[model samples]
Target: MSRAGSRDPALPARPRRTELALLLAALVLLALGFASAEGDIRGQLSGTVALYAGALAGAALALHTALRFLAPWADPLILPLATVLNGVGLCTIWGLHRVSDPRASEAADQLTWTLCGIALCGAALAVVPRPRMMQRYPYLTAAAGLVLLTLPMLPFVGIDAFGAQRWIGVAGFTVQPSEFAKILLVVFLAAYLSIKRDVLSLAARQLTIGSVKVFSQPRMRDLGPMTVAWGVAILLLVGTKDLGTSLLLFGVYLAMLYTATQRKSWVGIGVAMFAAGACVAWALFGHVQRRVTAWLTPFAPDTYEAEGGSFQLVQGLFALAEGGLTGTGFGQGRAADIFASDSDLILVSIGEKLGFTGLAAVVVLLFLLTERGFRAALESREIFVKLATSGFAFLLAFQVFVVLGGVTRLIPLTGMTTPFLAAGGSSLVSSWIIVGLWLRISDAARRPEPAAEHGADAATEVLRLRSG
Candidate 1:
């Protein structure tokens, strides 16, 4: 018998058990976290803690069950990591509720959104059996993405909040279409790049300076896609007045483009274009100017005291400083003092309560999740899967960087939501959907090849044919 055919089938079953075990451990940790957070908030454990734990348990188990049935070979760590991050978000929201006005509590709403996001994630898994299937409709997905991205500009339907016009009022609910649009755009980019990668990778000419081989210039035709992408990104910036989404859209495209073509010039060109766009935006838009000013001198008295200024940024800095190494503990910090503390500044809220150690842990979890995604890309055979998975991974990582950098004064605040940690329905839903897609891709990547079974049969047939 061939060595490939001699492998044990039961080995594949072991990871499934490991997945369940890890999920159970995550559930226990979450339940304890809820109880601890509630005890700290109300000065005693309450029925609300049980309710929160039960809801989280239901959502986690539903996702696990769906994965077991739909993608038995999927990467196991993705679910547990996502669940822990989501649990942390829930705990943070619940903790913040103690300091927020009773009339405006977001804890219950966030829990409801979490459950809904999990349900939608499961639905996505059930419907999309193969990640490759999505590659069939690149233009269709692009159209949907463009529509969603532009929906916030329509009169009466569009709503401006926090000085950014990125939300649309849909049937009485405010939706951030940019969040979901990002994923669709990624799908479109992956499909399009997979088809065009060879041509895009080809160098039309070489530029040499004293035999140094300074540059390999691409064909003029290949530049069309990047131009279109850049134009779309700039339009998003102008139409939405959201630097975060604008940067995210263009950055993700550049990452995917580089992944497809393995060309560094594309990234250089994309960066230069985005830099020019940002300069023009800074010159023309007051909000962009304000963001830059705040980033540069957040502590300046005039800037801090101005309306829509750096007060929130300064407060977040104070909270982080107060948190020190071991934070003030759950429900003990003045996280509510910062505007958008639960969404755009959730990391600062977490840092204030959980301290630097806890914040680092959360960042580590995000890193691991992103690492698993990149691993999926490396393991996949299909070009489309590789590009799509890498794109999604980069998107998540970049969004986190933008959010964290903004809050920490590492970069200007772009009003981006931290995935799984921020309190926003659109972001939460989109994050879970990305997890679902990752699970699908990982399953396909890890599944045992059918050719292994036929190896011995083929060997015998070849021997018989030679003897005859």
Candidate 2:
């Protein structure tokens, strides 16, 4: 195999020295924060600010890795966008503690999680030298993803939060393995599609009817592997009572399949399959049924059973309306009025406090990051890189659409997050990892290749010498 990318030659003379300097500065501030005399929480633990500054320092290092390991590639816009979103998450997490019933030192815990998440992001960048290195463990990665999706089935491992069983409790800390699962899922899909793209695209039948040639509908034989994979994913989600995950995973498959084949027919088939599955799920699963029904008439009249389930959705709308055009302010949203305002309702928090400005800001940043990711995919020559980046970018965009769309009454509330801008360690870390992969693809797509003729003359001379 070819060697990994070389160090960035055009990087400034000082390069990561600046980032290191900031980290050291952050540590010093953190130390002083502990030592400073304090009568209030803010005065005592200026540690929160120091910790976030450290997070920024870590982000710079990851950006450097993008330049080296991914080669010559950079997302000039993505890192800064993530910085703002992560900063927003941290700030919102801190400020909202004014009301959390469990309090559990919300801001301090968030700072701790932010520190942990950043550490995890740095370690991933450190260990995964080349993104393809992850390809070696395709089965293992997919299996791990299955395990994460199945966590809620294991009794005590997963937690039930506002009707979604998405969190895993391990040791002393609770985490959402699904966050990490999403990254590994991308790796597995990229590798799988790389190997199967030709078969998937080529294994087909065609028929001419009346003058039009159309491909035959796929057979169970042709679709066995994909069907099995999709069935397993859906079963895992339904088993775990996580319809949100079910929807997300299905979208990933559809996006990957479409990219690998570039077929418009598959889109129609996919919509059909999705509609069929939804009908099946809604009929057999009461939880899924409840979610759909609640979404259908969150504020509509006369459904006697529509009473309890719409509570969350209505509150989400109320928060958004409260914020109006301009937000209440950075640190002052009345989010506690809604149950579970911290997670699923985080958009509500943004909408209420930042109003249209903050809400618009959140939407724009993710949109820019997603756009850059697709740009990287378009630039990539490697099939896996193209599919990987594009598929994952679609995943982020779709998740945002689902969650935000739901909470804002644009769609049903699927209980998903707003990516990095929401609280939760798994969400935070997975988001940066997504950013890392985007950086990798962007680097590969943009990495300046030495001119194809860089050694042509020397190669000819060497050949002449050898022949002589």
- TM-score of each candidate? 0.94, 0.82
User: How many clashes (backbone N, Cα, C below 3 Å) per candidate?
Assistant: 0, 3
Q: Report how far residue 23 has shifted in candidate 1, in Å.
A: 1.3
Report the C-alpha lDDT of model 1 over 161-239, residue by residue, as the tens digit: 8788989897777889889988988988898888888888885477799979666677878767645754674596577
Regions of candidate 1 where Cα sits further than 4 Å from its true position? 1-3, 6-9, 103-105, 452-468
In model 2, what is the error at residue 86, expressed in angstroms? 0.8
lDDT of 1 at 127: 85
Candidate 2 has its poorest 10 consecutive residues by lDDT at: 32-41
Q: How far is 208's C-alpha from truth in model 2 (Å)?
A: 3.4
Residues 139-229 of candidate 2: C-alpha lDDT, one tens digit per residue: 7878888777777667777788656677778887788777777777777888787877777777777667888977555555756765675
Scored by lDDT, model 1 comes in at: 0.85
